[model samples]
Target: MQTENVTKYIVNWLKDYASNAKVNGFVVGVSGGIDSAVTSSLCAETGLKVLCIEMPIHQAASHVTRAHEHITQLKERYSNVSDTRVDLTPVFEEFKTEVSLEGKQATVDMALANTRARLRMTTLYYHAGLLGLLVAGTGNKVEDFGVGFYTKYGDGGVDLSPIADLMKSEVYAVGEYLRVPHSIMEAAPSDGLFGDARSDEDQIGASYPELEWAMQMQDEGKSLEDFEGRQKEAFKIYMDYNRRNQHKMIPIPICEIPNKFR
Candidate 1:
């Protein structure tokens, strides 16, 4: 589809969904990254009240800095835009202590990252509930739906996702078309999990283009047998992540008896 048509379609989709759900506005967690920036812009374009919240933890300096710049630009771009800064270090630390994950650095980091996402979700829901608004998810197709690169009840919990069907490359295309900040569009994508220690590519060991290609193949009903060497590896990683995180993508199982119970 054409870029303009896609943008309009997504905007209208969210608007209609929100209206039907009795939501008057949207709350988005803007990480000052391209995905969130694009999602925020689209939400604002729908004439919905867009609340862009910047929730940064101790390890996410670059993300925090970029968030401020994006928020400034968004303020200039949209009259209904509002920004909030929330530091999640204290909450993460307290949660870590309560969970007794003191000496486990990797475990603590994972927990802390999830805590940051959940904290942001909580803040968004708080404002959204008060304003009768929906929480807009910033996840892209390649990450959230394809690879499950999001927290279960954290960033993954949202009332609506404006860009969930778009891949990373498509999202960047929309970001460029929307005139999102160049720095954010060019910056390396990360989960802002471990400061400078890790990034999305570093954790996944494959770039979005490669992963998206594998996803496209899967979408086209092609089998992994068609790929060879590195392509196969990429597909394996994507499939592995999908399999491992299946629980996160679905609702909890419920016990059911048979027709007798009904």
Candidate 2:
């Protein structure tokens, strides 16, 4: 890919979209991950108001540090860029107190993890509404469509997704061109919703490169019978995630009323 050209294209696209929408600018949740770093940079490149928000809920120290570093660098590089931190830990705790925790341990833990993402989403939109800014999404192609790895109506809810068309590797390329902070580029990819250092690879059981390969294979219509050993295992993992999370990738289903009923 022509990294420079692609970066310009995305920046122009963002500028055009925001102009058409008549919004002041964009508000992005910076998670210190490659995607967010790249996204916020792209938004900044548009010379529009870019608000980088840090909403942490029991977040790991590394993630927080990287987020701060990136935001600081962004503000220094782009005059239109600014940042704010909203600690959501207490809010998360209060929410858990009011909800039922009677499910299986794993199930309850997963639900709470998703809750963290939803809380962050709410905070982002709150700022967006207050400032007349659009909520810019930080998701990439693999997480947004290939694996459906993000929380629905949580991080998945957004006013615009600037990098959803770029694959993970492509996103890294754009990040390199944008001069994203080195710490974020080197850190392992994570959702940071669980308040732990567990990488996205750990949760998905497949590294991005491996998943990218599997995604390509699936697109070519290859099946389990076509591979063996590790190849088969990786393919199966990709297929399982894709099938399970189809709801996130597709439009919400609606029950159509019969004309006669009306």
Candidate 3:
């Protein structure tokens, strides 16, 4: 890939889109992950007002440290970049109190984890509406398209996704070119929705490189019969996720009315 050209193209695209939409700037939820760091940097390069928001709900200390470090560095490097921290822990707790925590333990835990993401999404949109900014999504190709790892109507809710086409490795490359904070660039990729330091790999059971390979194979129409041992296992994992999360990757289902009914 032409790294420099791609970088310039994305920056120009963002600027043009914002100008066409008549929005003052973009609001990105910075999670101290490679995706958000790279995204916020691209928005800053547009020379438009970019707001980096930190909405933490029972977030791990390392994640918090990295988020603050990245935001501070971004503000220092780009005059148009600004930031605000919203502590959503209390709000999350209050919400839990109002909802029933019934059902299986694992199921309840998963639901709460998704709730954290939704709360952060709401916060980002709230700021976007108030500041006349577009909600910039930080999802990458693997998560957004390959695995569908993000929460729908949560982190998946966005006005625009600047990095959705870039693979995870490509996102890291862009982050390197953008000079994202070292702490964030090196930290294990995570959703940070579970309020723990567990990496995305732990949840997905496959590293990004492995998933990328599987995605490529799937794209090439390869199937389980073609591989053995670890490759088969990895391929199966990728296929399972892709199959189950097709809803996220496809358009929402709408019932069409019959001609006679109209």
Stretches off by above 4 angstroms in model 3 are none
Per-model RMSD to reference: 2.0, 0.7, 0.6
Residues 1-262, candidate 3, lDDT per residue (tens digit)? 7778899999999999999999999999998899999999999999999999999898999999998999999889899999999999999999999999999999999999989999999999999999999999999999999999999999999999999999999998989898988888889999999889999999999999999999999999999999999999999999999999999999999999999998
lDDT of 1: 0.83
How many clashes in each candidate?
A: 0, 0, 0
Q: Which is superior by lDDT, 1 or 3?
A: 3
Pairs in clash, predicted candidate 2? none
How close to the true structure is residue 177 of candidate 3, measured as C-alpha lDDT? 90
Report lDDT (Cα) of residue 176, candidate 2: 92
Model 1 poorest ten-residue lDDT run: 190-199
Q: Quickly count the clashes in candidate 1.
A: 0
Candidate 2 has its poorest 10 consecutive residues by lDDT at: 179-188
> Would you list the clashing residue pairs of candidate 3?
none
lDDT of 1 by residue, 14-36 (tens): 88998888777898988867889
- Candidate 1, pairs of clashing residues: none
**What is candidate 2's CA lDDT for residue 205?**
95
Q: What are the lDDT scores of the predictions, listed in order?
A: 0.83, 0.95, 0.94
